[model samples]
Target: MTPRARLGRLLNDALHRVMAEDDSVFVLGGDVADPQGGTFKITAGLAKAYPSRVFGTPVGGAAVLGVANGLALTGEKAIVEIPSGGSVAQSFDQILTMSSRLVSMYGRTLPIHLVVRCLVGSGQGDGAAHGRSPQRHFLGVPDLHLFELSPVHDPGEQLAAAIGLGRPSVFFEPRSLYGRYPLTPRAEPGVEVTGPFGGSRWMRLVVGAGAGGPSGVAAEVTVFCTGGTVARSVRAARALAATGVTVQLFVPSRLFPFDLEPVTGFVGPGSLVSVVDDGPGPAGWAGAVAAALATRLWGTLRKAPVLLASAASVVPAARELEDRVVISSTDIVRRLVRELETP
Candidate 1:
């Protein structure tokens, strides 16, 4: 099945699980009714099934989140679905000041299950406001959990898991992944098992050296990437392999509080490491990884790490312009080959 189908299945499972377990669990969003089903149709049939629990709110993001905060504080689990990261910016004041800071300020033991679902990435032509990924703004906010999904298949399971987890998670569903596949029914509860928050799972390694060295070409470089960029990295790895260069590709499933131990293990003495991300460069996951590696394995390493990220600019409105700015499979291949050949 396609990823879109998986997402729909996951969402259905999540709604069912939340309703069955907690009466307090409610879904609130802007114009997220049936037929239209918000923007992605993830909420389709939800409001119809659970009329009282699932309903639409005003267009104001702050008001929407504020309502959610009130519900959660009063012992209700509220899931507010924002249309995009741009919409989320309007609610930052409430999220940062009230929703996030309440636990410590009031000394209240409030475990709010708030999920802000938003569309990220390009290709939709949603203009600058709708295309931005403002996750960086919520990176370090306390009392809020950030979860990003990049599924090749089984989107429903992933969505169900995100909903059932019951934390204040900012569930970022890539806009590009929607409609990619059909929704599949989940066999078990989506949130039955909770993986490490802010942790990452190694997807694959792309390198020239398979096992033996000396007879095997020397493993010179490693490239780490995630999200839509993983597929690109894999292609780049194959291209590099053709030239007899060893390139290891590390694709992490989780983004925040990224587990760098596995990544650090891959980088040996004198070996070069590069990180590629679809998000903008400046202060992204790439920068964080580089810092961690430098701090953890400074004295023992032979060369400085190289971080490759999208140019620090907003995603373009035009498809061609966006394509150029976004990291491509060819771009990853070229960078890997060049870095490996250097010195």
Candidate 2:
């Protein structure tokens, strides 16, 4: 078997490729320089290779993003790294009020290329402050694209795409997935890029769709998940298959500017659609999808769409307590089973 590629290494490689090709691209974040190489080591060796382009900044999110915005304005592509997703709140003004609104404010489209990368979500017992799912808050914001790194896809491909977007964007890296080693071949550097809307995929399937349901249609369960949640949901979907349940699992790369087109086929009148998110319950990205699909599909759905996300509480550091707050594969399986068993 081929050795799996660690996500961190893929990101490091992507940065090297981008910076080498574009002298205008710069990387800024706390402790991103040599030896430190960033808090998570995702920027490892970047400072050494691109000494002038990659530099560490003082520990202030707002100031860091402010610098990035300034660089973007001057035709330079800036990739700003926030140590944790929670810290992005500190720079909300810089991103939402300043960078994102620049083109609209100027009354014309300007080349404001910026990529804000941060470690997001919870699963590790990192406690409240460090473990936060901030992706939900940025959804639907204009001119500011949102993306999350997936263990299933090539991180290098994703990073290159984000940089090439030439728009203000946020790329989320789930803290727990930094070490994930996906056994996949590396994609051709800069060959195929998805930009903001990075497509979706169906991981599992059931033959002939319907099993049995109240609506006389098959009791098909369709699950939509993103980012770190995709891996866990894959497990749950496979477990459901073992139990003789028909399950369809979908993973979307881009969170904002969401496209419902690709996922329409899997859902039907009798389909039980469930969205799994690692963020806050209901109000997160999963909730947005559930609400939109529910409104659009309306009376056609066998049951109302469901959102499976973290509980409405701070993520605890203790493993047992943390499990209650953060969503898991077991939680997904349990929820689907309960819904399927219901009359």
Candidate 3:
């Protein structure tokens, strides 16, 4: 892969490959079928390659999802894109009415597979509308599942694997990670990248020792984080390593139907697990993970692990203000040193 490689484009490539292999698979959305190939150019060239199957749509979320719902009803698979996370609020009724019932009613062979894709998270100066990650709204929604694309994992495999399950699902990629996650081979020889979870790995150990290869320093802190924050958490691990406090970085790929295995298995008597979230407050992903981990590991933990997320407030558009709201590597480093490791 070249230095300019991006997860979005690679995902488009995977979509193209899968579409070519399966005639029933089709994709449509605003800017998605354009020569520009999406806001980040992830879907480039697919329209021309599969002109019959890949096409563009109007900006209306309901209208776009409506078309997807139609395609799914007709024994066809559809991958629909909505621009941002908040944009999804408009399609809630459509999703609730249409997504899963159609799939199960129609049976597995003719499964109505739908992949709802959207861009989420804050980059640098994104405003309130564009910056918000809206998955939290669907936290308890029935049948509709939520997943994230981590920069540390392969985008195509994540996309295909989620779609292969033959159900309706929502998968979002963080805006900030598109440019930051390298597309080329690992610059560091010792590092490896794998998709969210293949098996019992649903609660995956993304970086550090469980990431395969030589196990370096033994893990002292079980660090939990999701997409967009994985990079930051990894850096925190590295920084803590320098100061003699080793941390094991854990990234969970799937959000709904929370996986307890790796985290439960990792923690033992006197062990600590830290959940580092990017977005604000004492809730959302961090809260859900903390609750689940605490329930299963209740008897095993030394103390309740610390959860570091954005401050309980609106995320700011200004770079400095935004930085203050979310967790960072420095936040992870200092928190580990003061809260977990230090006597």
In terms of TM-score, which candidate is strongest? 2
Residue pairs clashing, model 2: 210-218
| Leading candidate by lDDT | 2
Candidate 2 weakest ten by summed lDDT: 188-197
In order, what lDDT does every prediction score?
0.65, 0.77, 0.70
In candidate 2, what are the lDDT values of residues 230-318, reduced to their tens digit? 66876787678677766655556567777776556447668788989898787878999899889877787768887898888988989
Count of residue pairs whose backbone atoms collide, per candidate? 17, 1, 1
Which scores greater on lDDT, model 1 or model 2? 2
Per-residue accuracy of model 3 over 4-33 as CA lDDT, tens digit each: 567666676788888888898888788888
As for TM-score, the candidate ahead, 1 or 3, is 3
- Per-model TM-score, in order, reads 0.81, 0.89, 0.87
Better of 1 and 2 by TM-score: 2
Write down the worst ten-residue block by lDDT for model 1: 187-196
Better of 2 and 3 by TM-score: 2
Positional deviation of residue 206's Cα in model 1 after best superposition, in angstroms: 4.9
